[model samples]
Target chain A: MNEYYNSAYKPLLAIDCVIFGYEQGELKVLLTRRKQDPYKGAWGLATGFLHFGESLHYAAERVLKKQTGLDRIYMDQLSTFGEVDRDPEARVISLVYYALIKVESQTLETLEKNQAQWFSITALPKLMFDHETMIQMSWGKLRRKSRYQPIGFELLPEKFTLPELQSLYEAIHQKQFDKRNFRKKILATGLLKKLDEKQKGVSKKGAYYYVFEEGKYDELISQGFNFELKSMAFGS
Target chain B: MNEYYNSAYKPLLAIDCVIFGYEQGELKVLLTRRKQDPYKGAWGLATGFLHFGESLHYAAERVLKKQTGLDRIYMDQLSTFGEVDRDPEARVISLVYYALIKVESQTLETLEKNQAQWFSITALPKLMFDHETMIQMSWGKLRRKSRYQPIGFELLPEKFTLPELQSLYEAIHQKQFDKRNFRKKILATGLLKKLDEKQKGVSKKGAYYYVFEEGKYDELISQGFNFELKSMAFGS
Candidate 1:
């Protein structure tokens, strides 16, 4: 590496994972206590220094799995933060990615309690460094992705109700939506197949259950059909 | 600076700028020759190594100035590329930014041929090392940003004809639009102040010149109007 390049200036690059999980009908983000010199004992996004031989995607996945004991989750690169002093110790450039996980089934209860926990985004504590700005950016990306892609399915179980999907969108968007228009737009996408089931625990109405039709969504996308769910117009 | 932190694995970060300029009624991107080893003869995005203690924004702005000989242009961070072998010479991560420069004036002719040249996007050569992908991504961002913001004015002169503005849109979107509808939508925005002067070179009708009202556009955004130039229908 030295023979091929200049060795004078080298900045440390790290990868941070903003894992968003929907559990018990609320949107939550995973955080952990930093046990090092900078921001010691303060809650921050789960992060790790990148290994030399691995790719960014692999590093992000490794951090997610090591922290939560989960694998094969959906993650997307969000943005890179390179403020000179974002890290108090060094010029560390952090590439942030967001992960969507269904927390009800993948919860690691035995993970280091002093180091890790899921916090409701609405009631999050004051974070260290620029972690709060990263979360806000990830939240905005998630909201935009939810409307443009069938990502709401990533936050729910294998089977879910229309109301569950609507509620998830509302939570991510932080607004109310008209139920009829919401259902109309979502079902019109033709990407959800009604399952012969009902979510029995919550409602007497037993809202109809549905599963995301992966094949149909891909096929429709290939044919140029857009998946859009318009939020209820604000202050209308 | 190296008391507690290990400095063994730091990699040099570089900034590659995708400078966009509109000229000859087409969208253009600035490219440079790789002056050093790696791909010495191949054309690539204008780039330079990040200097110590300089923020990414400052490095990007500096590179833009070095290549274009222009200042205070429309610049934005697109994304960062960090594949281990992306540089071929070292583990170099490139922070890419997209910019808009006024090209119709003599400013573009003064560009140093040794460092940069503006190429029409459609006739661009095979770029070096994931640069083609970077250009495509930046182009997509440019299109989306144009629709949601008033940045499209950056590409036009201080005063331009309606046909010129339409041509700029067509060049970016790569599609033909209904002239009447385009005129109606733009005039409805009330953000274009018509000038008493007319462009005499084009037609007998002598298209009127217009100036973009940045203040009016900003006020309208605060009043809840979105800047949308794309067709609402599938094939309209």
Candidate 2:
């Protein structure tokens, strides 16, 4: 590494995971007590230093799994926090990634191992360093991602009704989307396949179930497609 | 700094700027030959290493000023590129920023320094070490920003006709937008202040001149407002 580069300062790179979990109909963020000396015992986003030759995705995934015993989470790079004093201890630059995970009872024991607990985003405890700003920005990023991406698909059934899908979005975004425009904007993306059977259950007129096609969705994103849901826009 | 951190590996941090300049009615990207070896003389986005006490914004601004002799440019963080082998010579993470600069005749000498040249984005020369991907992603980010922000204000006068503004958008986006929809959508944001007088002497009936109020625009963005322009539909 010394022979290859000529930079005077090598900042320690760390990956901080803002793990958002949908549990019991609430949006929660996972945090733990930092075991390091600078802000020891203070709550901070679950973070891990990156090793040489490690990809950022792998580093973030490794941290999420080690902290919560979860895998295969949906992750997106929110932003990089590189203020010189963001970390009081060292010149550390954090590459923050927001991950969407569904919390379940089964992982309670594993989460407790590292003193990691899920707290409602609305009522989070005091955080360490710039963790608070990172979390705040993650919310905006999450909202933006929800516009075109299937944000809650991991927590939804493979085949779900439009109403059920809208409910998940409303929970994550904390707003109600108009039923008519929500359906129209989502269908406009052409990523959902209309199933032949209608949803069975609570009412005489059951809404039809739709399956979100991942392959088509990926193509849309690749082409820089923008999907706009007019009524009850995100944060409206 | 050692008292603050306990990481074994310190990743060198660098800032690569995808400087987007609108010149001669075309979107151009600024690139220069890599001053350092392994890929010396290969075209790459203008880059600079971060100093220990410098903020990321300052570092990026400094690089931009040094490369093009321009200041007061609008900048945004696009993303961080940190693959294991993104830089063959070393393990370095590049915090990429995209800047919008209006190219003019007066700064030609400064741009010629260090062999920096403005290449049309569509006909970019082969770039070195993931710089091409950095530019590609900047386009998406810029497009999204243009939907809500004043993307071409620096190039236009404080008071300009709707046609002048629309022509700038079509040039930057490389496509045409519907006249009626563009006017309606822009006016809907309320960021544009309608001036009392219309354009003079061009024709029997001249278009009204609207002033884009930056103070109002900033307020709207602070509230996490998502502005949508329905007509022309951006990339549609």
Candidate 3:
């Protein structure tokens, strides 16, 4: 550390990650049981201290990767929560981040093997030291972001039916929307390209699949579109 | 600070504030000239170091209060920037915040006494390390937020005409809009309540004044109205 760095008394910096995944018509967060004292054995967000010569983004990504056993997750800085005495043992100011990952069967196995388990956002276990608040806020961000812009698409397979897309939105907003209005509102966005292919296994007369059009989304964004989902029947 | 707080090799925490004010139909940011070096005399955002036991919010407020001499302002966290060696002197991570303030003449004088001046976002002077990037990102946040919600209204007086309101929007988006369509779109939100009063000094036929209805705004928000200023007209 430089002399200037060492001159002042500093606060211990840390990162806490809230990993969200959409699975089986639900939004879930990954929690790992704390192995040590203070909040020993309690469910909590995957945590790591910022190491020397590491950027905050790198530290956060490293933490998420370690816990999820997967690389290149869609992670972002949700916000920083520095409540002075947030950490009981230390005066730590944490840069809290949230990651959205797709939970396929293979990835789910990878997570379980790494000692992390997915808990539904609504039915979370007792969390340690403000971790619950962190998770709640992360869910709030996801909900708000999904409303204003398109997300949760990453959790979907490349081709998914309108029903699957609606289920993802319902899981995020925690509300059952009217099927007719949901379909109308989503189609109005012009960002979802309808595919000719249909689901094979579920039924004889299968529903058509759709894929999110990234180029069209970007084009609409440049025109000041917020991906705003408005006037839709949220729950019927 | 507690003993546990002092138990680690911690990094110094700091905050930089980007104070935005709208004047003469242009968006401006408050800048102060540095009295000391590495970038001595360069223009920079109002900044302060986070002290022990002080939350990041409090530290940011103190910094803004010092610069603008305003007791209350609409301030929110923009994001955290920590690229290990960002500061040449130390490993410092800054929590940057942006604030929106009404620039009335009374408050403007207080800012001058504090040796801070407002610069148009488009014509900013060379800034200190990473301050420019911080300002740009803050602007991006503000633009996105204003598009999704009604924010520039804080920069307006208690009452104003549609032209005045439109001017504020233009300043924020940095683009002119078609007046007829802008009026039609704004009135449709029902967020604005028109007053019978009109400006006496401006012209013989003055425009009708209007005020934002907070109660209606809140009601609409609860109904999932995003305060979204969607497409009406961008440049004429």
lDDT values, one for every candidate: 0.81, 0.80, 0.83
**Candidate 2: which stretches are off by over 4 Å?**
A1-4, A157-164, A178-211, A219-225, A234-236, B1-4, B154-161, B193-211, B222-225, B234-236
Calculate each model's fnat, 2 decimals.
0.53, 0.74, 0.57
Candidate 1 chain A TM-score vs. reference chain A: 0.92
What DockQ values do the models have?
0.55, 0.58, 0.48
lDDT of 2 by residue, B1-236 (tens): 55436645887888999988765557788889988777889999989888879888999999988887778788889899889898877788899999877666226676666688889888999989999999999987777667656666765556888887887777767789888888877787887888998999877899899888989878988887656653355533
Per-residue lDDT of model 3, residues B15-134, tens digit only: 899988888888989899876556667889898778878888888888888887777778999899999878887788899999988777336567667767889999998988899999
Give the best candidate by DockQ.
2
- The digit string of per-residue lDDT tens for model 2 on A1-236 reads 44437645788889999988765556788899998778889999989989777888889999988887777878889888888888777788899999877666326677778888888888899999999999989987776667656676766657888888887777778888788877777787787899999987856999898898888878887887655553446533
Which segments of candidate 1 are over 4 A away from where they belong? A1-4, A108-114, A231-236, B1-4, B105-109, B222-225, B232-234
RMSD of 3: 3.0
Error of 3 at B37 (Å): 2.2
Candidate 2: chain B TM-score equals 0.83
Lowest lDDT 10-mer window, candidate 1 chain B? B227-236
Residue pairs with colliding backbones in model 1 are none
Q: What's the distance in Å from true for residue B217, model 1? A: 2.8
TM-score of chain A of each: 0.92, 0.81, 0.90
Tens-digit lDDT track of model 1 for A1-236: 54436744678878888989887768999888887767779999888877887777888898888777788989988888888989888888888999998777444653454378888989899899899999999998897677668887988988889998888877887787888888887888888999888888788778999999999988988986667653432311
The local lDDT score (0 to 100) that residue A216 gets in candidate 2 is: 83
Model 2 / residue B147 / CA error / Å: 1.7
Question: Could you give me the TM-score of model 2 versus the true structure?
Answer: 0.86
Interface RMSD of each: 2.6, 2.3, 3.3
